[model samples]
Target: MGCCNAVRLNKCDEYPTQYRTDFIRTGYRPLPFSFKECIKSAFYANNETGNIWTHFIPFLFMVHRAYNVINQFEDLTDPINFGYYVHSIGVTYVLIASTIAHTFCSHSELCFRKCYSVDRAAIIMQGCSVQLVFELYICPPSCYVAEGMGRNSHVILTLYCVLSTIMFCSSVHPRLGRFQRFLATLPFGIGSIMINFSCAVRYLYSSNAIESTCFGTTKGDHVLFYFHLTSACLAIFFYVTKLPERWYPEKFDIVGSSHQIFHIFVAISLYFQNRLIEHVTAEAKFKIETGELLREPLASACSQTVGIFLLTFITVHSVVALYYWKVQPTIQICKPPEKKE
Candidate 1:
């Protein structure tokens, strides 16, 4: 009772391993908090407060933005604008799903796993939805001339499915922890870059799309590749290093934590992502109306959405369900960490 008397306990020091998200984070709610308490804690200034609000605020913003997107077309099912709606729905769903996962993760292992699985699955769909629209309207001139419904397009789609599968499996594996999950994100990151590459190149460099109105109405529109790259880099740094909290866990426990920083940058990245979608959508619409765009638009965009739904459903639910059936009941709590002399 000597040194321990002055120190509050870390839940990870005693709880089952799956409940732990970060070794440096010390403000976890007790392992069996009820759903009501977990929801209530979102209001309290706990470690997850920032995580919850970052995604939740973005979710609300995107919901508003999606409503405006709906008004862009008279028919809800117009194929030309329909992919935009799919993208909007996917983004908003992931944001809200992230909010829910962070909010209720303390409820129980089952709830935690289920919520996070849903969040991860939503993210997969979001990536697919984004790349689908980009392929339809945001890709450059060469995309039409070289890969117009060609082999590269199918290759990209297959690559996404494969990488997403790796990410999903590593994410839910009982033996894999944060660091392994971080490694898993390498593949996830590759898939994400593939999703954004067509649009990102326009922001990063001169392109036929950029010279024309379909790309933009102004020169040097954003140079947003640097902006998003910085955000993603910062996010990865915090996620891997665990930052200032890694050095002084208690000082940053309730605030100034690395996860909070990570969440802030993630929200920023997604907000700008949606903005780019709106920007490119407007430009594409203008071109379509004026007959500037050649090559039929959205030949496979809707079909890809269906394939994405199937892939995500298979990989995501299988990972979660297999965890429940195989991993959950078998894992055991570990002995608390020992104090240094």
Candidate 2:
């Protein structure tokens, strides 16, 4: 039996390489350039401190979250499953795009503005993909005993992510300019509003069990709403007004920049938003399965909810900052080729 077990382990290890190679060939590479260059360019010249850290930090959080998912659900699923692996690859794509955008963006005039836009688009995709993967595990009724709640909640969350993705893609388009950015803001705004409104309606109609839970109350709902609102507003204002930094130009190059602030808030808000969903999903699952009161009070849940949000926010934001520090923009004014001097 011991010899048989040893042989089986060796065979299992060998099987994965074939699959891993397939993924390498077909899936997205995590970063396009050398790791050293990616880090170096992040702080070079753009003052893109927030942009670089935003994605970098989230990549770490995703690593942690992926681990938690594995530990928590070990029996029901395997961490090495294809769907799970592919989802992670998507995150790698986002990080690569973000790193590349930060690294080479300041290399040329064309690369500068384009990198910012590409980073924006990559973030949108990252946000959507995160929600999608979470849904795959939460949506099915396998874990939940209740029927209507699981299906309805899944549909609503999925729809919200889809709209958010569309809005992000449209709003971040390079050619759409300021006007398009404004239009793109609408979807996120609407989605945010709807989330609060639905929670309110759920409280009004649902029985005491759900209503009493953290997921339903207005006060509890505000935790997510306020942060998301602040984040989205900052991004919109920065893009539209082109504030302090834009007005001051060279003076704000290294710090005190509006774009940097916007990036920080956007990352923070995305973190908060995901936590809000995770809180509710975890609750909904418990409710459907046990049909008992939550282990913690609504208020306590709200606080935990907020903490998770900020934790994710800080980590991702740190990466954004470091990336920018390494890749500061090269500031040199052009003088019409200097007449061959």
TM-scores for all predictions: 0.79, 0.49
**Model 2 off-target regions past 4 Å?**
1-39, 43-46, 74-96, 107-121, 126-222, 292-341
Q: How many collisions between residues are there in candidate 1?
A: 0
Write model 2 residue lDDT over 1-341, tens digit each, in one string. 44223221111122222111111111111222344544554443324444566667776776676567546643333221323433444455566677567555434333443454455545544544444433232222222223344346434544554445444444433446556656556755654443344333443443432332323233454466457657767776875566675556456544555556566665566556555444544555565358553444332322222333234334444443444455334433211122334
Report lDDT (Cα) of residue 306, candidate 1.
Answer: 50
Give the per-residue lDDT of model 1 (tens digit) for 1-341.
Answer: 34223333354565566666564457666656767777777766667777888788888988987787677666665455656766787888888988999998777666766677677767777776766666655554354234344346645665565566446645765666556676457655776677656555555454444233244434323644456557877887897798887787577877778878887887677666666667766665666678775425444545655555556556656765675677566533333446678
Q: Give me candidate 1's TM-score against the actual structure.
A: 0.79
Global lDDT scores for all candidate models = 0.65, 0.45
- The prediction achieving the highest TM-score against the true structure is 1
Clashing pairs in 1: none
Residue 57, candidate 1: how far off, in angstroms? 1.5
